[model samples]
Target: MGVKAWLSKPLAAYVHKKQQHWIQHPVEAQKAIFDKIIRKAAGTKFGREHHFDKIKTHADFVKAVPVRDYEGLASYFELVQQGVKDVLWPGKPIYLAKTSGTTSGAKYIPITKDSIPNHINGAKNALLAYIHETGNAGFLDGKLIFLSGSPELEEVGGIPTGRLSGIVNHHVPGYLRTNQMPSYETNCIEDWEVKLDQIIEETIDENMTLISGIPPWVQMYFDKLIRQTGKPIKDIFPNYSLFVYGGVNFEPYRKRLRESMGRCIPSIETFPASEGFFAYQNEQQDKSLLLLLDTGIFYEFIPVDEYFNENPTRLTIGEVQIGVNYALIISSNAGLWAYSIGDTIRFTSIKPYKILVSGRIKHFISAFGEHVIGEEVEQAMDRTMAKYQSAELIEFTVAPYVSQDQGQSYHEWLVEFSRPPHDLGDFEKDLNMQMQQINTYYNDLITGNVLQNLKISVLPMGTFRSYMKSQGKLGGQNKVPRLSNDRQLADGLLAITSS
Candidate 1:
């Protein structure tokens, strides 16, 4: 290890100890840390002018500063896009992590030195927790393949702009740096067709031990890997033990991964974003858990109902209850105060604060004047799968489209089947029936109760992956966005359905 990394190890250890202490402590201790972060954040220029100081209680802060989506950051986002110094943070940002926002088009999120520590700490804590749970740290000692976005940094108005994957790639630890398959700075977008080929050429012979990325990209990578190697991924990388992924639901993608890597490979989920690496899979690996990063951010949970109800209730880390979904609001050192990430999560436990990402708040299907959430769709799909006794789906994405002449509206499912069912018609019928049963509003839309023009259709297998790649979004971190309520959905459907 280099001198800097060696020095960082001790600091990382210290941070890890503090995080462990916070995790084991009562909610009050965690809240105290959050209060201190809020106060410190309020002291910043953006916080001061934005009214962060006027808010005393957590409730007051939630009330005073409305939760902001990506569009809310658009005006100042251009400043960061230009790589201007002191725009978002105190100094020149260390790097810019590029990610696609739901509405604001491509986003260049600033990552400062102050903010990076949180990402690092979050990753460390995730691994440490996994180690404690699995009793295995060496499981990842073999070659680690991270199916990340193109490492190429795009210059926006003369400033470097790229997704979080590129920015994080620029700063990978030198020891691990040599181990990365594709150097992070390469232009992944430019070489779309040969991207996977280049990755395979770089690491096909190496003793790969761990694979990480979004489920779809990982699945695609293995598909190519198998075709090239003339062997299953497990046969080539016998040492592979763990699959680490985040950014989308893995349930639809897990069956294929297990089949490709064999049933023995374990999977872990992480919740990292351009803003900050927020939470990760608990050590036990039972489900994705939210481990508080006390030093880096102060967090608040807005009850999900607050979106529709004017009198929105907010909760601190202490007040969250099990099985309730909440909108994640964060105030971080990176200049985002009470920011709503547009992602929704449900708590499975309060003691350790475990959560399952329900779906993106903005990804709901409401075209027919019916609010259909991702969770509802997910449950419906799960039920349909169980009822039919079909092989697990590799991945699926849904869009709300309307028929032109008929003026009819309906739900379209783009399903990737692991193994095709014998009776395709029966499967489709069962799926549609379960969906209508799960959500009365959805059923009403289909039955012409809500909107007379509703319909349902299924795209051929591999259509979702094709659509994701065509959008320059093929990678380990980005899944075929499960729900698309934007204009892009219309365009995507036109392109894929026509083809």
Candidate 2:
């Protein structure tokens, strides 16, 4: 057997066994993980402030540390910025994974000595799990390209700061470096467009077998490759059998990516947040990813239907039901105590726990009492575009139009279409209909003229990409918010397109 295969075989088997054990004893596994995290941070200020000394169970932990959003935990993180030891995590964090998705300005998530290995090992274990189940170990022998952030590390008050992907790239296994693409020097190039050009130039002749990236940016890269080479992606990477993706929904991009490849290559979805590496796709048959119960993270779920409630029920793995949309809360070694990651997810399985990210907690539109979320908008757009087959939704954002000049407040859908819909008016009608059918509040608003039918504005191509680039969040762990409560995205998109 090849050295790679021989090495991976035992690791794969171990992962398989561990996952099965997790399935059989999920409660035990999670409790163990939670306790371990508590012990690790027991001496930290956050832990002491929350009375971690006496916090015995999940309920105690919840009672001690109320659920927090990024803003809620901002004070503790501020202390970490000044190189405070044991403020959140163990010692001062080794790095901060910077983000701008939900909050304004920049949010720096702590990456401690304890949490760093979890991030790196999650990706490694995910690969081992995939290979164990599908016998795809040979991909490790060939070139694998992780279209990551600029490997150029920076400093924020003595702590290293960079994108999560870039931070993880520094810890990539020495052996895998032999087959990984985009040389470290090229990776250190900061400009995304310039970096893309170099990545294309470097990988043009490589024997690539695996690639990992978020959907939209990777799609942009693939489109550029096709445009340059005048060939499908399959022709470029004939053995590219694995595409590991996360940070965005893949369903809408899936059809487009598949069409470009001219063949179906298996994919693995992951739910890796900057706070922690939470979940990874383990099984092949199901779309949901298995929650990594053994990680140094404690998970609690509050039903999205009741998330805004004064006293929403928090359920552990032992109490959670399948198919319910739940907002996830995490307490981790990184010192985030019961922090809401903002993303909402639904469980597909209870035993061992498999979940698919459903939406974001904050990115919802409810201007006219027609509460619509990220998943709803994306699904409706995907379905509407699929009905015509000629149209493709590259990117979109929706906002409410409640201006006095615009009679009857309604939704304004700013969509960037790769191929213009066969009938733009009809496509808008179908999309509006889809939205109304799923959400009765929306349907009632339309019926009573409380809100007019949703409006559609065909955006100029490359508008979303341009906006992202301008915002300096063009690639790696960044995404465009689909549904905004205000006109931030809508106004910004309009300005970008017009200019």
Candidate 3:
């Protein structure tokens, strides 16, 4: 073995063992993190405001800090933006992660010195865990491409501010920097399409081994590569062995991605956010991610069913159950206290605390009392697409559509298909059946005549891409929502298609 591979093997083993220690003693790890962060932040402005000093247990912590979304914490965040010290965490944050918000125009999440390690180390350990598990570290020698935001930062209150991925770009370790691809200049282009073309020009002939990005963006790169070279990605880069992705369910894009690459390869799914790194897939066979209990973040769970309750029941790691969807809340070293990031996750294993990203708390459809989630729709699409080998889906979204004339309602699936099935009617029927089987509420609505069978609106290829571009959300860390509760997105999509 080469020097890199030889050195990586022992390091991977050490990280793997360390990961197992936390995995074995999850409750203790979490409690330790909880105590450390709470005590550390007790002197900060938010800590004093919330009575963090008296918090002795989970119950006390819950009673002291109410669960809050970004809007709810706007006052504290505003203070931080005004160059205030000791506002949230002890002293000022090192960076601010500027993220696109829905109702709130833009959100600036703090990234303190202590909390930045969680984001960096979480990604590093995932790769090390993969190396340890698969006994394959050869990819470390070849070039790897991480499709991310620009590393360029703008100052906010004397602190650097940018997208989470962009902020992470500045922290790529020295060892990996040698193998990273797409020159720094190419990465800083503000226009995604221009950046993509430059990236293709820069690395089209290089020894590309691992490609990492959100699924859709990677798919875009692959498609453009094919168009430019008239060859599959496998032909262009034979050493490409691993795909690391997050931000969306991989199931829906699995078949298409495989076809683009001309074969299947190993993939790792991660659960990360601007809030903190929560989990990463440890087992190759299992798609579920192992929760990182020892990260600088303490987790809390509110059962999705009770999330809207005036006073929801808050549960710690010990109180959670497998398969129950919970709105993920966090109190982190970054000084976020009882903050709700709006994502929901379901535990798959309790022994090691494995989890699946079920959906977003705000991204669901319950128009007729049939609460269909992102996971359910994505699963239904996966199964339905699996039945048709000739079909290829680019992207899709689900929303409630009610006919004004007939007063009849149904779920509308706006699908952009690169290769449509031969029989549209049959595809629609199979998709509807799949949804009914997965979600009983949807089944009941259809059977009870409260709603009709879901309809598939065939959209041209690049429809969703064009829509995202028009909305100024074309690239890094942006994804089309799989499910929306209302028809706003549906109407907007149709309008774009028509124009």
Candidate 4:
């Protein structure tokens, strides 16, 4: 083995040991890491005057650094765009993970060497959970197929830029690296169509043991595979063992995927973003368990009302309460102090701190004049699916549509189904009924003349993939956004709602 390869395993082992030790003794871990980071930040002028001055205790660190959205990261983004150093961090970042923001066109997030370990550890924890759950470590020994974005670092105004998938690809261990279908950097083609076709062709004849990527892209590829081969995915490659994905909820996509695969493939959910990989599903897989990476970030949460406004009370991991939804606030090693990524989550438990992703704070329908959070939508959908003999949803998107005349507003849903419901009208009615039943407030808004209507439209088979592809958004990190709040974006999507 080469020097780097020889050194990697031992280095990984050492880091893994430290992680286990820290997990067992979190109090000591927090104090040591917190003091070190404080000292490091305090030693610098900007850190002392701007950062350290705001933080008195861990609690103060949570509160004083006001929760900020992507727009709040604009100044840091401007510095990176200009190729200036130390705008957010102390030194030049090793790489930047490019992702599309909801309102801010495209976001370029810097990741330093110190921050990379968080992603690595998060992935390791996922694998460990798989091992513990399945009792099969060797299940992951074969070639793994990662349906990731192209590794080509495009120059955004003369600075190197690549997607989060590409950056993570570049850092994978060499042993597994050689076994990957697409080599990092070379596999990601700039052309979206060509890349999809190439990815489909590559996986056709391979004995892919493990598959990983966003659900929509995976569904898209499989849809193409079925069409091309005239056979189901199980017949195409029966050797598949695991499905690893993140960037969106898998619950909506699970039923259809299970039917497509012909059986259950041990699926794993990872909570990752351009900023950092925050959490992963532990062995039980009841909910995503937050594996606190104290070395990389100090985390906090802020509760939001059904109206989508942020509440004043902020809670740390130590202070998080069970069964309450809170928007995530993060202060990371890369120098984002008290930043809100806009994603909301609810804790399933507190002793070990298991969390379920609620939805994005910005992706809800309030302009329609009725408050609808992700939880309410998810519960309603779950109940609807349950009534319809377990018909699984492949992908779906929700938006509020207003009539041109002055009248009550209505919600229009575009959903893709894996298995056709026995009765389409019945399925639609059941879904709308469940929506009213689950959230009485929403029902009151609808019945008491607050909102005019609610409508659910079933899209033609394969319409979701075509829509995503047309937008240049078909692949690993991109998702079929659950709620499209912007009127323009919503109208554009509605235009192709598939009659």
TM-score of each: 0.86, 0.96, 0.98, 0.89
For candidate 1, the clash count comes to: 12
Local accuracy of candidate 4 as per-residue lDDT tens digits, 171-273: 7776677558754433768666677788777768877778788877787677788889988777887877788888777777777677678778877888888
Question: Tens digits of per-residue lDDT for model 1 on 1-499?
Answer: 3353344445545645666666787476656755665666564445566676676677677666766766876666677666555554565566667777666677666666778777766765666666555555554455777777666776665556676766666666666665556644333644545777777877778878778887777877888888887888889888787788887776666656777775567767898888888778875547756656465677778777676566567677878888787888877767666678878888887666778888877788887666777877777777767665656576766777665635455677766676766676777777778778877877766676444432335556767667777876655466556777654765575578688
Per-residue CA lDDT of model 3 for 242-305, tens digit only, reads 9999998998898899999998888999988888998999889998998999989999999999
lDDT of each: 0.69, 0.85, 0.92, 0.71
Candidate 2 accuracy as lDDT: 0.85
Give the 10-residue window scoring lowest on summed lDDT in candidate 4.
1-10
Clashing pairs in model 3, backbone N/Cα/C closer than 3 A: none
Which clashing pairs does model 4 show? 150-188
State the lDDT of candidate 2 residue by residue for 90-180, as single tens digits.
8898999887745657889998877787899889998998988888687887789998888777898799998888899889988888999
Backbone clash count, each prediction separately:
12, 0, 0, 1
Q: Which is the winner by lDDT between candidate 3 and candidate 4? A: 3
Quality of model 1 by C-alpha lDDT: 0.69
In model 1, what is the error at residue 47, expressed in angstroms? 2.6
Q: After superposition, how far is residue 195 of candidate 2 from its true place, in Å?
A: 0.5
Looking at model 4, how many pairs of residues clash? Answer: 1
